[model samples]
Target: MKLKLILSILFVATCFVALGQEKSPEKGLIKISIMYPYSEGKTFNMEYYETKHMPMVASFLGANLVKYTIEKGLSSGIPNQPLPYLAIGTFYVKSLSEYQAAVAPQRDAFRADFKNYTDVTPVILVSEVVK
Candidate 1:
């Protein structure tokens, strides 16, 4: 009776502790991507995005930033279809918390710089690598 209750309590406590532990990233990395979907009349400046925006992001993110990659969309599945996205920029970070902490401080500055490259708003995705 009492032993059963004690065991139940212990089990619950163990679960709580496990849940509180930090989540590990896939291959020690968490990837954050920002995508700009193509639209008529939408404009993107690839040169500014490559030369300026990424370097600024790296500078602000600092040590937490593992690396970043930028992709230029060429085409969609159909032979002559327009690309789904104008560009996709991915940021690989050490961990979710580290990335959050690093970006929080510089978020405003980061967002402000977007106008220099493109007019389209980006869709952001954060994914955990599964290895």
Candidate 2:
């Protein structure tokens, strides 16, 4: 019937409008992602990173850090393909300035600890999370 068709059109239009709305990023929250790309002859000690390095970093971050996560790369999408990254570490903080202030004084300590873990240079990204 015409009523059924009209309702269907209205439902579709409502869905479109809902989907078009953009999600706003969380206020005063910053995400720092540290990624280590995979390469030939590169070495990564996951145990050292997870057990020692991250904990040290967390201690420095202190109350500013909300939470953190570590991810170990296994393989690429294609079967038998090499992984794109050796590892990834992400942490969330309440304030970017606070996080920076916390790490600035200890930058050298972090660099020195790197030699104890991996030779791969890490890529860092600061991002805002939207949901």
Candidate 1 per-residue C-alpha lDDT over 53-111 given as tens digits, one digit per residue, 9 for 90 to 100: 98778777777788899999988989888889999999998778877887798889888
Q: Candidate 1 regions off by >4 Å?
A: 1-28
> Weakest 10 consecutive residues, lDDT, candidate 2?
20-29
Best by TM-score: 2
- Per-residue error for 93 in candidate 1, Å, reads 0.9
What would the C-alpha RMSD of candidate 1 be, to one decimal place?
A: 10.6
- Looking at candidate 1, the ten consecutive residues that score lowest on lDDT are 19-28
> What overall lDDT, based on C-alpha atoms, would model 2 receive against the true structure?
0.91
Q: lDDT of each model, Cα atoms only? A: 0.87, 0.91
| Count of clashes, each model | 0, 0
TM-score of each: 0.75, 0.76
